[model samples]
Target: MKFFLWVALVVFFSGCNNSEKENTEINGDIVYDMYKPSEMSILMNEMYDYNLKIKQEILEGKTPVNFPTNFLNIYTAELSEFKSRNETFQAYSSLFVENQKEICNTDAHSDISERYNNAINLCISCHKTECTGPIPKIKKLLIN
Candidate 1:
Protein backbone atom coordinates (compact mmCIF):
# COMPACT_ATOMS: atom_id res chain seq x y z
CA MET A 1 0.00 0.00 0.00
CA LYS A 2 2.81 2.45 0.95
CA PHE A 3 4.67 1.57 -2.28
CA PHE A 4 1.58 2.38 -4.34
CA LEU A 5 1.15 5.73 -2.53
CA TRP A 6 4.76 6.73 -3.33
CA VAL A 7 4.31 5.88 -6.99
CA ALA A 8 1.13 7.99 -7.23
CA LEU A 9 2.83 11.01 -5.67
CA VAL A 10 5.77 10.74 -8.07
CA VAL A 11 3.42 10.51 -11.03
CA PHE A 12 1.47 13.58 -9.92
CA PHE A 13 4.57 15.72 -9.48
CA SER A 14 6.05 14.64 -12.79
CA GLY A 15 2.80 15.45 -14.57
CA CYS A 16 2.71 18.89 -12.99
CA ASN A 17 6.24 19.67 -14.17
CA ASN A 18 5.51 18.57 -17.69
CA SER A 19 2.36 20.63 -17.84
CA GLU A 20 4.25 23.70 -16.81
CA LYS A 21 6.72 23.18 -19.62
CA GLU A 22 3.96 22.50 -22.13
CA ASN A 23 2.10 25.67 -21.17
CA THR A 24 5.14 27.75 -22.16
CA GLU A 25 5.47 26.31 -25.64
CA ILE A 26 4.15 27.78 -28.89
CA ASN A 27 3.19 25.64 -31.92
CA GLY A 28 4.85 22.61 -30.27
CA ASP A 29 8.17 24.42 -30.12
CA ILE A 30 9.78 25.41 -26.82
CA VAL A 31 10.29 29.15 -26.48
CA TYR A 32 13.38 30.34 -24.71
CA ASP A 33 13.63 33.27 -22.27
CA MET A 34 10.09 34.43 -22.63
CA TYR A 35 9.60 37.74 -20.86
CA LYS A 36 6.35 37.88 -19.01
CA PRO A 37 5.61 41.53 -18.43
CA SER A 38 4.39 42.36 -14.95
CA GLU A 39 1.19 44.17 -13.99
CA MET A 40 2.94 47.34 -15.03
CA SER A 41 2.39 46.14 -18.56
CA ILE A 42 -1.19 47.24 -18.16
CA LEU A 43 -0.10 50.83 -17.74
CA MET A 44 2.15 50.53 -20.76
CA ASN A 45 -0.77 49.24 -22.81
CA GLU A 46 -2.89 52.13 -21.63
CA MET A 47 -0.25 54.58 -22.76
CA TYR A 48 -0.23 53.05 -26.21
CA ASP A 49 -4.01 53.15 -26.37
CA TYR A 50 -4.02 56.80 -25.43
CA ASN A 51 -1.61 57.56 -28.25
CA LEU A 52 -3.72 55.60 -30.71
CA LYS A 53 -6.81 57.55 -29.78
CA ILE A 54 -4.97 60.81 -30.22
CA LYS A 55 -3.79 59.68 -33.62
CA GLN A 56 -7.36 58.97 -34.66
CA GLU A 57 -8.39 62.45 -33.65
CA ILE A 58 -5.55 63.81 -35.75
CA LEU A 59 -6.61 61.76 -38.74
CA GLU A 60 -10.01 63.41 -38.56
CA GLY A 61 -8.32 66.80 -38.95
CA LYS A 62 -8.92 67.83 -35.37
CA THR A 63 -6.02 69.22 -33.40
CA PRO A 64 -5.62 67.69 -29.96
CA VAL A 65 -5.61 70.42 -27.32
CA ASN A 66 -3.74 68.33 -24.76
CA PHE A 67 -0.76 66.10 -25.44
CA PRO A 68 0.76 63.26 -23.43
CA THR A 69 3.52 64.33 -21.11
CA ASN A 70 6.18 62.74 -18.93
CA PHE A 71 4.97 59.22 -19.60
CA LEU A 72 8.46 57.76 -19.72
CA ASN A 73 9.07 58.78 -16.12
CA ILE A 74 6.36 56.36 -15.09
CA TYR A 75 7.95 53.15 -13.93
CA THR A 76 7.12 49.77 -15.44
CA ALA A 77 8.37 46.28 -14.75
CA GLU A 78 11.30 45.26 -16.94
CA LEU A 79 12.34 41.88 -18.32
CA SER A 80 15.97 40.85 -17.92
CA GLU A 81 16.34 39.84 -21.56
CA PHE A 82 14.90 43.20 -22.59
CA LYS A 83 17.66 45.36 -21.17
CA SER A 84 19.00 46.27 -24.58
CA ARG A 85 15.51 46.55 -26.00
CA ASN A 86 14.50 48.85 -23.18
CA GLU A 87 17.50 51.05 -23.83
CA THR A 88 16.62 51.34 -27.47
CA PHE A 89 13.02 52.11 -26.58
CA GLN A 90 14.10 54.80 -24.15
CA ALA A 91 16.30 56.50 -26.72
CA TYR A 92 13.48 56.79 -29.23
CA SER A 93 10.92 57.56 -26.55
CA SER A 94 12.92 60.58 -25.48
CA LEU A 95 12.37 62.07 -28.89
CA PHE A 96 8.65 61.40 -28.68
CA VAL A 97 8.45 62.97 -25.26
CA GLU A 98 10.43 66.01 -26.37
CA ASN A 99 8.17 66.54 -29.33
CA GLN A 100 5.17 66.38 -27.05
CA LYS A 101 6.73 68.94 -24.79
CA GLU A 102 7.43 71.29 -27.64
CA ILE A 103 3.89 70.98 -28.93
CA CYS A 104 2.42 71.71 -25.54
CA ASN A 105 4.75 74.57 -24.67
CA THR A 106 4.23 76.53 -27.85
CA ASP A 107 1.23 78.06 -29.56
CA ALA A 108 2.49 77.01 -32.98
CA HIS A 109 -0.02 74.70 -34.61
CA SER A 110 1.78 74.59 -37.94
CA ASP A 111 3.98 71.55 -37.21
CA ILE A 112 1.92 69.86 -34.50
CA SER A 113 0.64 67.19 -36.87
CA GLU A 114 4.05 66.54 -38.30
CA ARG A 115 5.64 66.20 -34.86
CA TYR A 116 2.99 63.74 -33.76
CA ASN A 117 3.62 61.61 -36.82
CA ASN A 118 7.34 61.75 -36.20
CA ALA A 119 6.77 60.42 -32.67
CA ILE A 120 4.84 57.45 -34.01
CA ASN A 121 7.62 56.80 -36.51
CA LEU A 122 10.14 56.55 -33.71
CA CYS A 123 7.88 54.04 -31.97
CA ILE A 124 7.74 51.94 -35.12
CA SER A 125 11.49 52.03 -35.62
CA CYS A 126 12.19 50.78 -32.11
CA HIS A 127 9.62 48.01 -32.30
CA LYS A 128 10.92 46.96 -35.72
CA THR A 129 14.40 46.37 -34.34
CA GLU A 130 13.66 44.88 -30.94
CA CYS A 131 10.25 43.15 -31.01
CA THR A 132 8.50 42.86 -34.30
CA GLY A 133 5.51 40.99 -32.95
CA PRO A 134 3.58 44.19 -32.28
CA ILE A 135 4.36 45.80 -35.61
CA PRO A 136 0.81 45.45 -36.84
CA LYS A 137 -0.71 47.08 -33.81
CA ILE A 138 1.92 49.83 -33.77
CA LYS A 139 1.38 50.60 -37.42
CA LYS A 140 -2.27 51.23 -36.69
CA LEU A 141 -1.15 54.17 -34.57
CA LEU A 142 0.24 55.98 -37.58
CA ILE A 143 -1.64 59.19 -38.38
CA ASN A 144 -0.90 59.35 -42.07
Candidate 2:
Protein backbone atom coordinates (compact mmCIF):
# COMPACT_ATOMS: atom_id res chain seq x y z
CA MET A 1 0.00 0.00 0.00
CA LYS A 2 2.81 2.43 0.89
CA PHE A 3 4.60 1.76 -2.40
CA PHE A 4 1.45 2.29 -4.44
CA LEU A 5 0.70 5.63 -2.67
CA TRP A 6 4.25 6.91 -3.31
CA VAL A 7 4.08 5.99 -7.02
CA ALA A 8 0.71 7.77 -7.44
CA LEU A 9 2.03 10.94 -5.82
CA VAL A 10 5.05 10.91 -8.06
CA VAL A 11 2.89 10.39 -11.15
CA PHE A 12 0.61 13.27 -10.16
CA PHE A 13 3.54 15.64 -9.61
CA SER A 14 5.13 14.61 -12.91
CA GLY A 15 1.90 15.30 -14.77
CA CYS A 16 1.67 18.72 -13.18
CA ASN A 17 5.24 19.50 -14.28
CA ASN A 18 4.41 18.52 -17.87
CA SER A 19 1.37 20.80 -17.86
CA GLU A 20 3.53 23.69 -16.61
CA LYS A 21 5.94 23.20 -19.47
CA GLU A 22 3.05 23.25 -21.98
CA ASN A 23 1.72 26.46 -20.44
CA THR A 24 5.11 28.14 -20.76
CA GLU A 25 5.41 27.08 -24.37
CA ILE A 26 1.92 28.33 -25.19
CA ASN A 27 2.29 31.70 -23.41
CA GLY A 28 5.89 32.38 -24.56
CA ASP A 29 8.78 33.33 -22.36
CA ILE A 30 8.94 37.00 -21.50
CA VAL A 31 12.74 37.15 -21.67
CA TYR A 32 12.90 35.74 -25.17
CA ASP A 33 9.76 37.52 -26.40
CA MET A 34 11.11 41.05 -25.99
CA TYR A 35 10.82 43.34 -28.98
CA LYS A 36 13.59 43.01 -31.55
CA PRO A 37 14.17 46.11 -33.66
CA SER A 38 14.34 45.76 -37.43
CA GLU A 39 17.58 46.52 -39.28
CA MET A 40 16.37 49.95 -40.41
CA SER A 41 15.27 50.84 -36.92
CA ILE A 42 18.67 49.90 -35.53
CA LEU A 43 20.51 51.83 -38.23
CA MET A 44 18.32 54.87 -37.74
CA ASN A 45 19.05 54.81 -34.02
CA GLU A 46 22.78 54.64 -34.66
CA MET A 47 22.49 57.48 -37.12
CA TYR A 48 20.61 59.53 -34.57
CA ASP A 49 23.29 58.97 -31.95
CA TYR A 50 26.05 59.73 -34.45
CA ASN A 51 24.29 62.93 -35.48
CA LEU A 52 23.87 63.95 -31.87
CA LYS A 53 27.62 63.67 -31.41
CA ILE A 54 28.17 65.70 -34.56
CA LYS A 55 25.85 68.34 -33.22
CA GLN A 56 27.94 68.62 -30.06
CA GLU A 57 31.10 68.86 -32.12
CA ILE A 58 29.65 71.73 -34.14
CA LEU A 59 28.57 73.50 -30.96
CA GLU A 60 32.14 73.29 -29.64
CA GLY A 61 33.50 74.97 -32.79
CA LYS A 62 34.79 71.71 -34.25
CA THR A 63 34.04 70.39 -37.72
CA PRO A 64 32.65 66.87 -37.99
CA VAL A 65 34.99 65.08 -40.36
CA ASN A 66 34.08 61.42 -40.04
CA PHE A 67 31.17 60.15 -42.12
CA PRO A 68 29.94 56.79 -40.92
CA THR A 69 30.01 54.56 -43.99
CA ASN A 70 27.23 52.56 -42.38
CA PHE A 71 24.93 55.47 -43.12
CA LEU A 72 24.88 54.20 -46.68
CA ASN A 73 23.19 51.05 -45.43
CA ILE A 74 20.06 53.12 -45.04
CA TYR A 75 19.36 52.35 -48.67
CA THR A 76 19.39 48.60 -48.06
CA ALA A 77 18.50 48.11 -44.43
CA GLU A 78 15.35 46.14 -43.71
CA LEU A 79 12.41 48.15 -42.45
CA SER A 80 9.80 46.93 -39.99
CA GLU A 81 7.49 44.15 -41.16
CA PHE A 82 4.63 46.54 -41.87
CA LYS A 83 6.69 49.19 -43.67
CA SER A 84 7.74 49.17 -47.32
CA ARG A 85 10.25 51.21 -49.31
CA ASN A 86 8.81 53.80 -51.68
CA GLU A 87 9.92 56.54 -54.07
CA THR A 88 9.62 59.29 -51.48
CA PHE A 89 11.76 57.33 -49.04
CA GLN A 90 14.38 56.79 -51.68
CA ALA A 91 14.42 60.47 -52.65
CA TYR A 92 14.74 61.65 -49.06
CA SER A 93 17.45 59.09 -48.35
CA SER A 94 19.42 60.25 -51.37
CA LEU A 95 19.19 63.85 -50.29
CA PHE A 96 20.19 62.85 -46.79
CA VAL A 97 23.32 61.10 -48.08
CA GLU A 98 24.20 64.16 -50.15
CA ASN A 99 23.79 66.48 -47.19
CA GLN A 100 25.79 64.12 -44.99
CA LYS A 101 28.63 64.02 -47.49
CA GLU A 102 28.72 67.78 -47.62
CA ILE A 103 28.97 67.95 -43.86
CA CYS A 104 31.95 65.59 -43.83
CA ASN A 105 33.77 67.04 -46.84
CA THR A 106 36.21 69.66 -45.65
CA ASP A 107 36.52 71.09 -49.14
CA ALA A 108 32.77 71.36 -49.73
CA HIS A 109 31.60 74.90 -50.38
CA SER A 110 28.52 74.68 -48.14
CA ASP A 111 28.67 75.84 -44.53
CA ILE A 112 29.03 72.93 -42.10
CA SER A 113 26.23 74.06 -39.84
CA GLU A 114 23.83 74.49 -42.73
CA ARG A 115 24.70 71.08 -44.13
CA TYR A 116 24.32 69.46 -40.72
CA ASN A 117 20.94 71.05 -40.14
CA ASN A 118 19.81 70.07 -43.64
CA ALA A 119 20.67 66.46 -42.98
CA ILE A 120 18.68 66.63 -39.77
CA ASN A 121 15.82 68.26 -41.60
CA LEU A 122 15.84 65.51 -44.20
CA CYS A 123 15.36 63.04 -41.38
CA ILE A 124 12.39 65.02 -40.12
CA SER A 125 10.91 65.29 -43.59
CA CYS A 126 11.23 61.57 -44.30
CA HIS A 127 9.78 60.66 -40.95
CA LYS A 128 6.86 63.00 -41.59
CA THR A 129 5.75 60.82 -44.49
CA GLU A 130 6.68 57.37 -43.23
CA CYS A 131 7.16 56.98 -39.52
CA THR A 132 6.07 60.12 -37.71
CA GLY A 133 6.73 58.56 -34.32
CA PRO A 134 10.36 59.65 -34.37
CA ILE A 135 9.81 63.21 -35.59
CA PRO A 136 9.95 64.77 -32.13
CA LYS A 137 13.12 62.93 -31.25
CA ILE A 138 14.76 63.70 -34.60
CA LYS A 139 13.83 67.33 -34.21
CA LYS A 140 16.12 67.50 -31.20
CA LEU A 141 19.06 66.76 -33.53
CA LEU A 142 18.70 70.20 -35.14
CA ILE A 143 21.61 72.51 -34.33
CA ASN A 144 19.44 75.40 -33.28
Candidate 3:
Protein backbone atom coordinates (compact mmCIF):
# COMPACT_ATOMS: atom_id res chain seq x y z
CA MET A 1 0.00 0.00 0.00
CA LYS A 2 2.85 2.43 0.85
CA PHE A 3 4.56 1.63 -2.45
CA PHE A 4 1.37 2.42 -4.33
CA LEU A 5 1.02 5.79 -2.48
CA TRP A 6 4.61 6.76 -3.36
CA VAL A 7 4.07 5.91 -7.02
CA ALA A 8 0.85 7.99 -7.06
CA LEU A 9 2.66 11.01 -5.58
CA VAL A 10 5.48 10.73 -8.13
CA VAL A 11 3.00 10.50 -10.98
CA PHE A 12 1.10 13.56 -9.74
CA PHE A 13 4.30 15.64 -9.56
CA SER A 14 5.44 14.44 -12.97
CA GLY A 15 2.11 15.37 -14.51
CA CYS A 16 2.23 18.82 -12.97
CA ASN A 17 5.69 19.46 -14.38
CA ASN A 18 4.60 18.32 -17.84
CA SER A 19 1.58 20.63 -17.70
CA GLU A 20 3.78 23.59 -16.93
CA LYS A 21 6.06 22.72 -19.84
CA GLU A 22 3.05 22.48 -22.13
CA ASN A 23 1.83 25.90 -21.02
CA THR A 24 5.12 27.49 -22.10
CA GLU A 25 5.28 25.70 -25.45
CA ILE A 26 3.30 26.00 -28.66
CA ASN A 27 3.50 23.34 -31.41
CA GLY A 28 6.65 21.97 -29.75
CA ASP A 29 8.32 25.42 -29.79
CA ILE A 30 8.80 27.66 -26.76
CA VAL A 31 7.72 31.21 -27.55
CA TYR A 32 8.07 34.39 -25.55
CA ASP A 33 6.05 37.57 -26.03
CA MET A 34 8.63 40.33 -25.75
CA TYR A 35 7.72 43.98 -25.54
CA LYS A 36 8.57 45.75 -28.80
CA PRO A 37 9.21 49.46 -28.56
CA SER A 38 7.57 51.83 -30.99
CA GLU A 39 9.66 53.52 -33.70
CA MET A 40 9.74 56.80 -31.79
CA SER A 41 10.80 55.03 -28.62
CA ILE A 42 13.68 53.35 -30.43
CA LEU A 43 14.70 56.62 -32.04
CA MET A 44 14.57 58.41 -28.69
CA ASN A 45 16.80 55.80 -27.06
CA GLU A 46 19.28 56.12 -29.90
CA MET A 47 19.17 59.88 -29.59
CA TYR A 48 19.87 59.66 -25.87
CA ASP A 49 22.87 57.42 -26.42
CA TYR A 50 24.17 59.70 -29.16
CA ASN A 51 23.78 62.74 -26.95
CA LEU A 52 25.56 61.00 -24.09
CA LYS A 53 28.54 60.39 -26.35
CA ILE A 54 28.45 63.99 -27.49
CA LYS A 55 28.41 65.17 -23.89
CA GLN A 56 31.46 63.04 -23.11
CA GLU A 57 33.33 64.47 -26.10
CA ILE A 58 32.47 68.02 -25.10
CA LEU A 59 33.70 67.39 -21.55
CA GLU A 60 36.94 66.10 -23.04
CA GLY A 61 37.29 69.46 -24.87
CA LYS A 62 36.42 67.95 -28.23
CA THR A 63 33.68 69.37 -30.41
CA PRO A 64 31.29 66.92 -32.00
CA VAL A 65 31.56 67.03 -35.80
CA ASN A 66 29.12 64.39 -37.02
CA PHE A 67 25.47 65.27 -37.00
CA PRO A 68 23.50 62.04 -36.91
CA THR A 69 21.32 62.46 -39.99
CA ASN A 70 19.01 59.86 -38.51
CA PHE A 71 18.04 62.40 -35.88
CA LEU A 72 15.87 63.98 -38.51
CA ASN A 73 13.63 60.89 -38.37
CA ILE A 74 11.99 62.37 -35.30
CA TYR A 75 9.64 64.07 -37.68
CA THR A 76 8.43 60.79 -39.18
CA ALA A 77 9.10 58.03 -36.67
CA GLU A 78 5.97 56.46 -35.27
CA LEU A 79 5.38 57.50 -31.67
CA SER A 80 4.05 55.28 -28.91
CA GLU A 81 0.36 54.56 -28.85
CA PHE A 82 -0.22 57.23 -26.23
CA LYS A 83 1.84 59.98 -27.87
CA SER A 84 0.92 62.22 -30.79
CA ARG A 85 2.99 64.45 -33.09
CA ASN A 86 1.24 67.65 -32.16
CA GLU A 87 2.28 71.23 -32.83
CA THR A 88 4.17 71.68 -29.57
CA PHE A 89 6.09 68.46 -30.12
CA GLN A 90 6.90 69.55 -33.66
CA ALA A 91 8.15 72.95 -32.50
CA TYR A 92 10.37 71.46 -29.80
CA SER A 93 11.73 68.84 -32.18
CA SER A 94 12.63 71.48 -34.72
CA LEU A 95 14.42 73.51 -32.07
CA PHE A 96 16.22 70.40 -30.85
CA VAL A 97 17.50 69.69 -34.36
CA GLU A 98 18.73 73.24 -34.77
CA ASN A 99 20.58 73.05 -31.48
CA GLN A 100 22.13 69.73 -32.44
CA LYS A 101 23.33 71.28 -35.68
CA GLU A 102 24.97 74.09 -33.78
CA ILE A 103 26.96 71.60 -31.74
CA CYS A 104 28.27 69.88 -34.87
CA ASN A 105 28.83 72.91 -37.07
CA THR A 106 31.22 74.78 -34.83
CA ASP A 107 31.86 78.44 -35.75
CA ALA A 108 34.77 80.58 -34.61
CA HIS A 109 32.48 82.18 -32.04
CA SER A 110 30.21 79.21 -31.25
CA ASP A 111 30.51 77.77 -27.74
CA ILE A 112 30.23 74.03 -28.21
CA SER A 113 29.55 73.54 -24.52
CA GLU A 114 26.67 75.99 -24.48
CA ARG A 115 25.20 74.61 -27.69
CA TYR A 116 25.35 71.08 -26.31
CA ASN A 117 23.72 72.23 -23.10
CA ASN A 118 21.01 73.97 -25.08
CA ALA A 119 20.32 70.77 -27.00
CA ILE A 120 20.05 68.90 -23.72
CA ASN A 121 17.73 71.59 -22.38
CA LEU A 122 15.47 71.21 -25.38
CA CYS A 123 15.22 67.50 -24.65
CA ILE A 124 14.32 68.26 -21.03
CA SER A 125 11.74 70.83 -21.99
CA CYS A 126 10.13 68.57 -24.57
CA HIS A 127 9.93 65.69 -22.12
CA LYS A 128 8.40 67.93 -19.50
CA THR A 129 5.36 68.31 -21.71
CA GLU A 130 5.26 64.96 -23.52
CA CYS A 131 6.97 62.11 -21.66
CA THR A 132 8.14 63.13 -18.22
CA GLY A 133 9.71 59.75 -17.56
CA PRO A 134 12.98 60.51 -19.39
CA ILE A 135 13.52 64.03 -18.00
CA PRO A 136 15.79 62.86 -15.18
CA LYS A 137 17.92 60.79 -17.52
CA ILE A 138 18.04 63.64 -20.03
CA LYS A 139 19.22 66.09 -17.37
CA LYS A 140 22.38 64.05 -16.94
CA LEU A 141 23.32 64.94 -20.54
CA LEU A 142 23.99 68.56 -19.61
CA ILE A 143 27.70 69.47 -19.74
CA ASN A 144 27.63 71.13 -16.31
Candidate 4:
Protein backbone atom coordinates (compact mmCIF):
# COMPACT_ATOMS: atom_id res chain seq x y z
CA MET A 1 0.00 0.00 0.00
CA LYS A 2 2.84 2.43 0.85
CA PHE A 3 4.58 1.69 -2.47
CA PHE A 4 1.36 2.38 -4.38
CA LEU A 5 0.86 5.69 -2.53
CA TRP A 6 4.45 6.76 -3.26
CA VAL A 7 4.03 6.01 -6.96
CA ALA A 8 0.79 7.98 -7.06
CA LEU A 9 2.44 10.99 -5.40
CA VAL A 10 5.31 10.89 -7.88
CA VAL A 11 2.93 10.76 -10.83
CA PHE A 12 0.78 13.62 -9.50
CA PHE A 13 3.77 15.85 -8.87
CA SER A 14 5.20 15.14 -12.34
CA GLY A 15 1.86 16.00 -13.94
CA CYS A 16 1.67 19.27 -12.04
CA ASN A 17 5.19 20.24 -13.15
CA ASN A 18 4.39 19.48 -16.77
CA SER A 19 1.28 21.62 -16.71
CA GLU A 20 3.17 24.58 -15.27
CA LYS A 21 5.91 24.32 -17.89
CA GLU A 22 3.37 24.33 -20.71
CA ASN A 23 1.02 26.88 -19.17
CA THR A 24 1.53 29.75 -21.57
CA GLU A 25 1.62 27.78 -24.79
CA ILE A 26 0.99 29.22 -28.28
CA ASN A 27 -0.69 27.52 -31.22
CA GLY A 28 2.56 26.87 -33.09
CA ASP A 29 0.68 24.63 -35.47
CA ILE A 30 -0.87 27.77 -36.95
CA VAL A 31 -0.42 26.39 -40.44
CA TYR A 32 -2.82 23.57 -39.66
CA ASP A 33 -5.19 25.68 -37.59
CA MET A 34 -8.06 27.12 -39.63
CA TYR A 35 -8.24 30.35 -37.67
CA LYS A 36 -4.55 31.18 -37.89
CA PRO A 37 -4.36 31.02 -41.68
CA SER A 38 -7.37 33.30 -42.08
CA GLU A 39 -6.05 35.63 -39.41
CA MET A 40 -2.65 35.86 -41.12
CA SER A 41 -4.29 36.49 -44.47
CA ILE A 42 -6.39 39.29 -43.03
CA LEU A 43 -3.34 40.85 -41.42
CA MET A 44 -1.46 40.79 -44.74
CA ASN A 45 -4.38 42.42 -46.48
CA GLU A 46 -4.37 45.17 -43.89
CA MET A 47 -0.67 45.69 -44.40
CA TYR A 48 -1.19 46.15 -48.12
CA ASP A 49 -3.91 48.69 -47.56
CA TYR A 50 -1.73 50.45 -45.01
CA ASN A 51 1.16 50.61 -47.47
CA LEU A 52 -0.96 52.62 -49.90
CA LYS A 53 -2.07 54.92 -47.10
CA ILE A 54 1.52 55.37 -46.03
CA LYS A 55 2.43 56.54 -49.50
CA GLN A 56 -0.49 58.96 -49.55
CA GLU A 57 0.52 60.32 -46.16
CA ILE A 58 4.08 60.84 -47.36
CA LEU A 59 2.73 62.72 -50.37
CA GLU A 60 0.42 64.81 -48.18
CA GLY A 61 3.32 65.44 -45.77
CA LYS A 62 1.32 64.45 -42.74
CA THR A 63 1.14 61.81 -40.05
CA PRO A 64 -2.10 59.85 -39.79
CA VAL A 65 -3.59 61.73 -42.69
CA ASN A 66 -7.34 62.25 -42.61
CA PHE A 67 -7.63 63.58 -46.16
CA PRO A 68 -9.74 60.68 -47.42
CA THR A 69 -11.63 60.75 -44.10
CA ASN A 70 -12.11 57.32 -42.34
CA PHE A 71 -8.79 56.25 -43.83
CA LEU A 72 -6.93 56.71 -40.58
CA ASN A 73 -9.69 54.99 -38.67
CA ILE A 74 -9.60 51.87 -40.84
CA TYR A 75 -5.81 51.75 -40.84
CA THR A 76 -5.60 52.02 -37.08
CA ALA A 77 -8.28 49.38 -36.62
CA GLU A 78 -6.56 46.92 -38.92
CA LEU A 79 -3.13 47.52 -37.36
CA SER A 80 -4.53 47.02 -33.88
CA GLU A 81 -6.22 43.79 -34.93
CA PHE A 82 -3.06 42.32 -36.45
CA LYS A 83 -0.98 43.36 -33.46
CA SER A 84 -3.46 41.82 -31.07
CA ARG A 85 -3.28 38.51 -32.94
CA ASN A 86 0.53 38.57 -32.95
CA GLU A 87 0.59 39.18 -29.22
CA THR A 88 -1.90 36.39 -28.58
CA PHE A 89 0.15 33.95 -30.67
CA GLN A 90 3.40 34.68 -28.89
CA ALA A 91 4.01 32.25 -26.04
CA TYR A 92 6.68 34.38 -24.43
CA SER A 93 6.59 38.02 -23.40
CA SER A 94 7.68 40.67 -25.91
CA LEU A 95 8.12 44.42 -25.85
CA PHE A 96 6.48 46.25 -28.75
CA VAL A 97 6.59 49.99 -28.29
CA GLU A 98 3.89 52.11 -29.92
CA ASN A 99 5.13 53.94 -33.02
CA GLN A 100 1.92 55.93 -33.34
CA LYS A 101 2.00 57.38 -29.84
CA GLU A 102 3.55 60.69 -30.88
CA ILE A 103 1.68 61.14 -34.16
CA CYS A 104 -1.60 62.05 -32.47
CA ASN A 105 -0.05 64.67 -30.23
CA THR A 106 1.83 66.45 -33.01
CA ASP A 107 1.40 67.17 -36.72
CA ALA A 108 5.04 67.61 -37.67
CA HIS A 109 6.27 65.75 -40.76
CA SER A 110 9.59 64.83 -39.16
CA ASP A 111 7.85 63.49 -36.07
CA ILE A 112 5.64 61.37 -38.28
CA SER A 113 8.65 60.03 -40.09
CA GLU A 114 10.33 59.18 -36.82
CA ARG A 115 7.21 57.48 -35.47
CA TYR A 116 6.83 55.47 -38.67
CA ASN A 117 10.46 54.40 -38.52
CA ASN A 118 10.13 53.33 -34.90
CA ALA A 119 6.98 51.36 -35.68
CA ILE A 120 8.63 49.53 -38.57
CA ASN A 121 11.65 48.91 -36.38
CA LEU A 122 9.41 47.37 -33.75
CA CYS A 123 8.14 44.93 -36.39
CA ILE A 124 11.68 44.14 -37.48
CA SER A 125 12.83 43.65 -33.92
CA CYS A 126 9.96 41.33 -33.02
CA HIS A 127 10.33 39.31 -36.21
CA LYS A 128 14.08 38.97 -35.69
CA THR A 129 13.52 37.50 -32.25
CA GLU A 130 10.48 35.39 -33.08
CA CYS A 131 10.30 34.70 -36.85
CA THR A 132 13.56 35.21 -38.73
CA GLY A 133 12.06 33.90 -41.96
CA PRO A 134 10.54 37.30 -42.86
CA ILE A 135 13.62 39.30 -41.96
CA PRO A 136 14.30 40.43 -45.53
CA LYS A 137 10.90 42.07 -46.10
CA ILE A 138 10.89 43.51 -42.58
CA LYS A 139 14.34 45.04 -43.00
CA LYS A 140 13.23 46.69 -46.25
CA LEU A 141 10.45 48.50 -44.41
CA LEU A 142 12.95 50.46 -42.33
CA ILE A 143 14.14 53.91 -43.40
CA ASN A 144 17.64 53.49 -44.80
Using Cα atoms with residue i matched to residue i, what is each candidate's TM-score against the true structure? 0.58, 0.74, 0.74, 0.44
On the 0 to 100 scale, the lDDT of residue 34 in model 1 is 30
Tens-digit lDDT track for model 4 on 10-70?
4343321121222232675212111222334355446536644674575577556332333
Alpha carbon lDDT at 79, candidate 4: 29
lDDT tens digits, residue span 39-82, model 2: 88788889999999989999898998888999999999986554
lDDT by residue (tens digit), candidate 3, 1-144: 864554444434332111222224579854432335668878888999999987888888888788999999989998645456899989999999998888888563768888888888999888887767567678888887
Best by TM-score: 2
Root-mean-square deviation of each candidate, in angstroms?
11.1, 14.1, 13.0, 14.2
Where does candidate 3 have its weakest 10-residue lDDT segment?
A: 14-23
- Rank by lDDT (best first): 2, 3, 1, 4
Candidate 1 residue pairs that clash: none
Candidate 2 positional error at 34, Å: 3.3
lDDT against true structure, model 3 = 0.75
The candidate that achieves the highest lDDT relative to the unseen native structure: 2
Off by over 4 Å in 4: 1-36, 65-97, 107-110
- As a whole number from 0 to 100, the lDDT of residue 29 in candidate 3 is 55
After TM-score superposition, the amount by which residue 60's alpha carbon in candidate 1 deviates from its true location, in angstroms, is 3.6
Task: Give the range where candidate 4 is weakest over 10 consecutive residues by summed lDDT.
Answer: 29-38
Q: Write the per-residue lDDT of candidate 1 for residues 28-136, one digit (tens) a residue.
A: 8544333344343544576688777777776777667666543655334453232434666667667766665554445766676687767777767766665454567
